[model samples]
Target: MPNVRPGEKPEIARLPLFREMQEEQRERIFSGSFLQVFPPQLTLFELGQHPDFLHVLIDGLVELYATSAGRDTTMRIVEPVTSFILAAVVTDMPYLMSARTLTSSRILLVPAALVREVVKQDCALMQATMRELALAYRDMVRALTDMKLRQSAERLGNLLLQQERRQGGNGAVQLKAEKRLLASLLGMTPENLSRAFAVLGQHGLEVDGAQVRFTDQAALEAFSRPDPVKDDD
Candidate 1:
């Protein structure tokens, strides 16, 4: 279970858009935001639902996915200090993907109408929002390019490399999410993930349960052949 708390005005004020806004604007936005906590696996919202709030993740992870033909495909993982489904909220359209908690999480729900109002009145806020949207679009493009150009094994290798980077290039890294979820995020089946791991083993990647230790980082990187243009950290 997750614990809920009153929304902290300072927290909302510190966000990029709010930070740039005037004090009155910041207060107005904060006044309408509410803080909530959610337990793991709780669905925050469903696909095709009208956007009501701009959900800002203060802590923990949220998985964004879409279902088609009864198969769920993981789209993106929302990390802290970020908002999800912003385009939908801004456009007053239904969400294209569903979101759920990956772990116990703290989130702030800012009313979509309020956000739209502020954006309309504040030029700086509008510019900041446009910048965020552009970056998000670029990230989506990179992800699509990665999926199209790389094999599943290579994708897994790049993911491990990213984890290693997060750990300050340490040789050892631990999987934060479950293997099944990781497989989905990488656009592969559990069986395919297993095979990818096996293939990586020959290139000096060692996996023992959730922990992964790279015996030879150079060899692994060489095998993965990651392209910086297609892969972003």
Candidate 2:
């Protein structure tokens, strides 16, 4: 991993959270921050480890998971421009879940102590942190509701629809992550996911390897029954 040099200050300052902070506050945080690149499948932090840094994914994917009875359950996928394990960092507690890279990634690590100190001294920073925390909590609630109420097929259909929207509402959607990882994200076994896809095929959803096409969007939506309040993009 390479350290962030002084010349990269401007680029680092461009990050949403950092951009909202005062110059001095930003400096305080950046003084303790460094950038690192990791290869895919590298564990960035383990469960129960001390939250020494607030890690922000600059690019690439990160998986947050909890282990139980020797099996790992995926909790969330951290996309770029987002911070992970912030609640633990803010509380000065151990990380409740382990984080690992899903692809080669660039990350910014800001010392958690500096983050807490800056939040204490800066109202803007505190408000920003609160907003981020609130959004994350809301997302968790939605995910729980989805898992509780939706069947495996419905979940997969809704996910495809969301991906379609992300791809500018085109009828064709491509899977960015592997199907096995997608299965983990949806809280289903790979076999179950395959079955789910097969079931969805009856409702105008076509799956050919990583590519999915919707033959009848209306019919598929009717089958998926996506609720705006519950379905997060």
Candidate 3:
């Protein structure tokens, strides 16, 4: 329902196949596809649900989570221009995670059979798909490793520093999601997150609410580095 339509400028189409394919190939992929729009907080699929289509996320963020015995845990957040429920689509398994829209989004649905057809006929598409899956796996491994190897406060500090880097030096930074979600993503409880902020300040992180200013950029970066410790670990 939000402004999910392609703007005046030519849209990238958000599919690796779409980008590499010729017009005919593009047409083939879209032959029987459908575009659906969803509002923010919309749940597209629940955990353990069977995935019927290979969904290409054209716009907006999707939060993936899991629930068991009435307990829900946020897993990851997918930004626009990526596939949602990719693991299920690729392996023909029920979704291990649920996807909910973090903002208004437009999704392109391609039948799984047609997606397989494209993979077979188009070598580039197949390769790109493999690369995407591999990268996703690598990221999961890294996240797991970080969690296992770092303390909660350190992990939260690193997450904040990474976000600052992503936003090009932390001026007017935004979380892009609620604090609870962010806390989950960092593998810390909300109260722990608050303590992490205080810890960072003790270690020289300047925090003014959401807009964290760095009193000493070099000191902060050094502390955030993998092999260094400033005042404390």
Winning model by lDDT? 2
lDDT of 3 by residue, 1-233 (tens): 22223351135344564676556655676656777778999988887778888777888888999888987777888776778666677777889988889999878777776777777777777787787787778768767877888887777666666666667864324567777887888777889888877877766577665667666656655665543321111
Against the reference, the lDDT scores of all candidates come to 0.86, 0.87, 0.71
Runs of candidate 2 exceeding 4 Å displacement: 1-3, 230-233
Reference-based TM-score, model 3 = 0.84
Give the TM-score of each candidate.
0.90, 0.92, 0.84
Worst 10 residues of 1 by lDDT: 1-10
Superposition error at 29 for model 1 (Å): 0.8
For candidate 1, the per-residue lDDT at 233 reads 46
Scored by TM-score, the top model is 2
Those runs of model 3 whose alpha carbons end farther than 4 Å from true positions after fitting are 1-14, 169-172, 226-233
Candidate 1: Cα lDDT at 113: 99
Give the per-residue lDDT digits (tens) of candidate 2, residues 116-231.
98999988789889988988898788678779999999988987887798778889898877888889989999999999999989999888888999999999999988766643
- Which 10 consecutive residues of model 2 have the lowest summed lDDT? 224-233
Clash totals in order: 0, 0, 0
User: Which residue pairs come into collision in candidate 2?
Assistant: none
Candidate 1 vs 2: which has more lDDT: 2
Report RMSD (Å) for each prediction in the order shown: 2.8, 1.9, 4.9
